[model samples]
Target: MSTQPAPASRPFSIMPPPPPPVPLPVRARSFALVGTFTASVFLSAFLLFLVQPMFGKMVLPLLGGSPAVWNTCMLFFQAALLGGYLYAHLSTQKLGVRAQVGLHVGLLAVTALLLPISVAGRSPEGSDAPIPWLLGTMLLTVGPPFFVLAGTGPLLQRWFAHSGHRNAADPYPLYAASNLGSMLSLFAYPALMEPRMRLAGQSAAWAMGFGALALLIAGAAAWVWRPVPPSAERADAVPADAPALSHSRTSVPWRERGIWTFLAFVPSAMLLALTTYITTDLSPVPLLWVLPLALYLLTFTLAFARRPPLPHEHMLWLQPPVLMVVVLLLLSGFVEEAVAAIPVHLAGLFVTGMVCHGELARRRPAVRHLTEFYLWISVGGVLGGIFNVLVAPVVFNNVYEYALSIGLACLARPWPQERRGWRGQAMMAVRTVAVTAALLYIGANSKDMNPGLLMASAAALMLLLTLALARTPLWLALCLGTVMMYSTVKAIREPGVLLAERSFYGRFKVVEFGIIERFHVLRHGSTLHGAQSLRNPRDPITYYLPHGPVGQIFAATAPRAGRRKVAVVGLGTGTTAAYARAGEEWTFYEIDPHVVRMATDRRYFTYLPDSPAKTRIELGDARLSLARASEPKYDMIVLDAFSSDAIPVHLLTREAMGTYLDRLAPGGVIAIHISNRYLDLEPVVAALVRERGLAARVSSGPDGKRKRYESIATWITVARTEEDLVIVAADRRWKPLTDRRVPPWTDDYSSLLSVFEW
Candidate 1:
C-alpha cells in the first residue's frame, strides 16, 4: 500500500484521507423564528381586540348603546372566532403545511381589502329586528377580517411546532402571549384609542396594524418553510411503535374533547353573563364593560402561561365556595348594592374562569394536536355565547342564563372520570334524585317564606352536598342544579308578572305586589323603574311623585301657552306621561320596543293609556329620534332615560344636552333624572349645564322613610336662566348645583370612574 502510494506520489494523503468532512450548513438562528411567531400571534390578537371595541363604538349610536348591543357583538365575535379556529384545525390537519400557509396568507390579504372597518348598510331604522340587524351588520362589517384574525393564533402556533425552534415541542406558552396582546388591546381601546381618536381614525390605524400582522405571519410561515437537514428530518419521524410524547399522535378521545369543550364553555358564557350583570345592575359605562372583559382575558393569560402561578387544582378548589357566594348574591338581591356586588360578581367570574381555563391548560395536548384543542375551545365559546345571547332570551323569561352559567361552572370541575362501583354509583344516583326532588320542592315552596331562612337552608344544603356528594359527578351536577333551583325559586316566588319580556334593551319584569297587592311595578335587573298603584294609576309614584323634582318640573310647565307639548326620553312604564294634561301633545322617545309595548299595553301599564294627553311613541334611540324630530318645541323636556339602574351614557353627554336644549322652547326647563344607587350624576349634569352657560338646580327627594312606591330621587333642572326656573330656584329644597370640577361628558369621552360613587 505504501509503495503504491509512493508510486502514485500524488498530492498530500497516504491512504485515502477521510473525504473532507462535509461542513454542515449553518442553521438560521432560531431566536428570530420563535420571536417572529410570538410577535405574529401578539399582533394578530391586538388587531382583533382593537377592532372589536372600535367597531362596537361605531355602531353604538345606531343600536342606542344598550348593553344588549355589546352582548350581541360578543356573540358575533365568539361565533367568528369559532369559525377561525375550525378553519385553522381543518387547514392544519387536512391540508399540507405549505397549503395551510398559502391559504392563511391569502385569507389575511383578502381581509385587508375590507379594512378600515365601517358599518355596511344603514342601521336598522324603525325595524323591530334589532338583534337580527345587528348580527347581519356585524357579519358584513368585520366578519371576514375577524375570522382571519381569529385563525392567526392557532394557525401560527401550529406552524411554530414544525419550525424547528428550540421551544417548538410545546406551543401552549404562545397562547398566553396571544391573550396578553388581547388584554393590552382591550385596555387600550377605552384608555388610548376611544379617548384620543374617532372611529374613522381608529379604524385606519387598526388597518395599518393588521397589515403589519400579515407581514409578521408571512415571516413566520417562511421560517416554517426553511429547509432542514436530512438527519433532523429523519429524527423527527416517529417509529410506528414509538410511544407518543404525552399522547401526541394518539387520536384525542371523544371524552377528552368533550371535557375541553365543556371547560371552555363555562368561562365564555360566564364572561358574557358577568358583563351583562355588571353593566345592567351597576352602570353600562365603558369602564364596567372593560373591567369584566379585562379580567376575562387575564384568566386566559394566566392559565396558558409557561409557568402558571396558580395550579389547576388550586383554582378548582377555590371556585366552589366563591361560586356559592355568587349564586347567593344573585338570588338574594344582594347585587343591588353596586359597590359590594360589582366586586363579588367580578371575584366569582375570576375564580370560575380560572378553574375552567386552568383545567383546559392542564389537559392541553401536545403541539401536534394544538390546533384541534383550540378548535374545541372555540366551539365551546361559540356555543356558550349563543346560549347567552340567543337561546336564553328565546327560551327563558329572565336573565336565567346567568344562573344557569353558574351551575354549568360548578359542573365544569375536573373530577374523576372513572365511575365508582355499582354500590357507590347507585348511592350517587339516589342522592341525585333526592337533590332533584329537594330542588323542585324549593322552587315550588320558596315563595312566602323568609328569604333569610331560605338562603340559610339552601346554604346548609349546599354545604352538605359538597361534603357528602362532592366526589361524584352526578352529585356535583345535583349540587349545581340545587344552586340553580335556589336562584330560580326566588324569581318564581316573586309575585305578579305583568309582562316578563326580553328585548335588545334587557329583561323587563313588570311585577305586582304591595299592601293588598295593589301596586304594579316595572323592574329591570333588580332596580324598580316605576310602580303604579292600581287604585291610583294617574298619580305619579316612585320618581314621578308629585312633590319630587319630576313633579315640580311638570307643575311649573303645566301653564304653558298653546298645547303643553312634552317629550320624554325613557318610557319606563310611561310614568312621565301621567304628568301630561288633557289635550297636551305628549311624545315618548323610547329605544326599547318592549318598554314602549309594556307602557302602552293597558293590561300591563296604563300610564300611556290613562294619560290625559294625546300620546305618540317614537321607537329608536332618544337622541337620534330627537334629532330627526322637527316638531314644535316642548316647554318641558324630561330626560328620564335611565335603564333599570344603568345610565344611557349616550343620553347624558354634552352633545345630548344640546339636543335637548335645541328641542326646548324659550323659557323651557330641561329636567334630568339623576337619582342612582351607584353614581352621583348631579356633578355630571352640573358640569354639563355650566359648560352650556345654563342655570342648574338639583332637588334631592325626601330622605325619610320611602313610601311603598316612593324612592329617593335626585333631579337636575337646567333652564335658559334663573327666570325660567323661578319656582325651582326660589324653593330652598332645590339646591343650586355649583360643582363643575368634573368635565362634562362628550360623545368622545366620559369617565364612570371619575364620577363613580362608592
Candidate 2:
C-alpha cells in the first residue's frame, strides 16, 4: 500500500520470459536434423561392421584359417570403402541436396534386391588361386551392399550440414558416433550374434536391419525437401582452419591432402600388421582379430570428437615410446609367448593408431570439404591394405612388413622443421650415433650375452633414444636400422641350425639342438612340428614319438593285410611317414610346398626319405588338393595340418570331414592331432563325431610330463563305427571324447570364439 512497495514492483523482468521456449516448428526442425541423420549413420555403420566378421566367418573355411585370409578380406573392404567415398564425393558435388537424396535412395532400393546374403560356392574348383577366388567370392556375395553402406556415413554427414541446425558448423562429431556404432557391432557379433545364431540366421537378421536402415535413410531424406535458411548454409561455409577464411573458395593444398593420406596410411597399415602378428605368431583365434580392430576403430571415435577426450599432442608424445616397446618386443623373442606378446602388440596398435587418427582429426577440412577429406582417407586405407596384403608378401621373404610399418609410423610424427642451432644439431647427432652404436653392439654380442640382459639393455637404450630424438626426423631411419640389424643377427643365424625358409604360409626353421645327442627340430614359429634324433634317424622324437597317438595309429593301421594306403594332411617334418612299413603307399598333402621340400630333404628331416614305404608329396592347400584328387580309399587318414599353432579351420569343417570320409576305406579310422596350447580341439572333433554318427576317443599325454625332444600330445581318433575305433579306444591311455553339446563346424558357420582357451 506504500509508494516504496510500488517502486519495488517496477524492476519486474529484463529477461523477457526466456524467449518463448524456441518456436515449435523451429525446435521440431532442429530435432529432426540431428535425430534422423545420426540414426541413419549409426544403423548404416552397424550393418557395415556386422557384415565384416559375419562374412569373414563365412569365407574362412574356403581359404583355411590363415591370418592372410583376414588380410585379403580387409583389402576388399578397403577398396569398397574407397569406392563408396569416391561415389559420395562426386555425387555430393554434382547433385543438389534433393537429387543426392533421390540418387542414393534409388541405389539403396536397387541394392536391397541382393539382401539376405549367402555364400555362393564352397570354394574355387581346380586350378584356381585361393586368395583371388576368395576375393571374387566376397565381391559377388557382399560387394554392392557394402559399398552402398559405406557411402552413407559421409553422405548423411553432408546432409546434416545443410539441415539449418545451429550446430551445423561441425559435422565430424557425427563421424565419432558412426564409429561408435561400428565398435558396438563388432562387440555384438562375437558376444551375441555369433554364439546364438548360425550364419544364415545372422544374414537374415542383418537384412532386416538393412531394411530398417533404408527406412531411416528415407526419413533423413525428408529434411532435404524442407527449405534451408541462408544463415544455416553459411554456417557450413566456415573455414576448417579458422582465422584464415580468405581461401574458402580455393582448393585444398596438395600438401594438406598428402598429410591426410599419410596420417590415414599409418594406422590402416599398422592395423593389419598387428592383426597378422597376433593371429599368425600369437594365436590365430578370430577373437584376437577383434581386439586390434576394435581398438583401431575406437581411436577414430576418440579422435574425431568435437572436444576430444584425449589430446592429439599427447598421443604424439606417447606414440614413439610405445612404438619403441613394440620394436623391442619384436626383437626380444617374447613374440613366441602369447601371454607376453599379445598385450604389447594390442597396446602398440592403439597408441600409434591414436597418433595417426588424432592428426587426421586435427587437420580435418571444413564441412564444405567433408567428402574430399573422407575420400583421401579411404584412398590411403586402400593403399595401405594393398601394401600389406599384396605387396609385402611378394617383396619380403619374412614378415618384415610389420617392422617396416612400425618405422613408417615413426616417420609420421610432426617433427620440427625449423633449422636447429649448432648445439641442438650436435646433440641430435650424438643421440643418433649412440643409439646406432648401442643397437649394433647388442646385435654383435647377442650370441655371447645373456639374452634377457641384452633385451633389457636394448629396451633401456631405445627408451633413452626415443626421449632424445622424439622431436627429430632422424628417428625413422635410426629405428629402422636398429630393427633390421637386430632381426638379422638374431633370426638369420643360430648355433647348430641347419636351414631356415620363409613362405607366405609361415617361417620354418630346422635347427639341431641337443646337449648329449643332437636332435633335428622342425619348428614353425614357436611350435614344434617334429624333431628327429640324429642317433636314430628313423626315430620320431616330438609329437610323433613311439608312445604317442601317432605311433598307436600306425601300430594299428599300418600293419593292415593288403596294399595299405595312408594319407597325411600335414607333412610336418614327414614324421608320420616314419611309421610306414614296406610296400605301404603313403601320400602327404601339404599346403606349403617349402614344407614338402624341407621334410623330404635327407639333410633336414629325412622322415620321408628314411621311411621304408614309398611316399609321394602333393603340393597345394590340403583340402583343395584332397578335393581334386582321384578317389582312393585309404586304410588310415591323418589330419595334422597346422599353421603356426592354429589348425586350418577348413580342414575341420563338416565338408572337410565328408571329404575325408569319401577318401577313407570302409572301417578305416581318422587320426587327428588335436594337441594345442590354446584350443580345445577335442570338443571340436567330438562335436563333428556326434553330428556325423561316428565314434571318437581322445588320447591325452601325461599331465606336466616332459621328455627329451618331446611335447605333450592330444589325439582324437574318429571312425564310422565304435568297433572301428576299438584299437585306440580300448587302450587305457585313450578315453572317450567329451560329448558336450556344441555346434558342428560348417562351411557356412563356425565360432572358434567359443572354443578359445583365453
Write down the RMSD of all candidates, one decimal each: 10.6, 8.6
For model 2, residues 418-452, the per-residue Cα lDDT tens digits are 67899977877887777767765665565578878
Please give the lDDT score at residue 695 for candidate 1: 90
Tens-digit per-residue lDDT, 1-758, candidate 1? 01111121111122223212112233566788778888998888988888877777777777667667877787788878888888888887788677888888898888888877887457677646689888888887789999999988998887766665545556778999999999899778766776566567778898889888888988998986776554332112221211222344446678778888898888888888778777665554436667777888899999888788886566665666566566556655655457776887889899888978877776676555788889998888888778778787778776677777887876777556455898987887887677556545554455556889887867775665555555554466666667577667776776566678777667778877866649888778667788888987888888888887777777676677347888888888888877777778988888777787778888878988977778898877788778777887988888888765656777888778888888999988888888876677878888887788999888888666776878778888889988988987888888888584787777656656566676
Number of backbone-clashing residue pairs for each candidate, in the order shown: 0, 0
Question: lDDT for each of the candidates?
Answer: 0.75, 0.76
Off by over 4 Å in 2: 1-32, 60-71, 120-125, 129-137, 234-236, 239-249, 283-286, 421-423, 435-467, 476-484, 494-497, 628-630, 702-706
Write down the lDDT that model 2 would get.
0.76
In terms of lDDT, the poorest run of 10 residues in model 1 is 1-10
* lDDT of model number 1: 0.75
lDDT of 2 at 264: 90
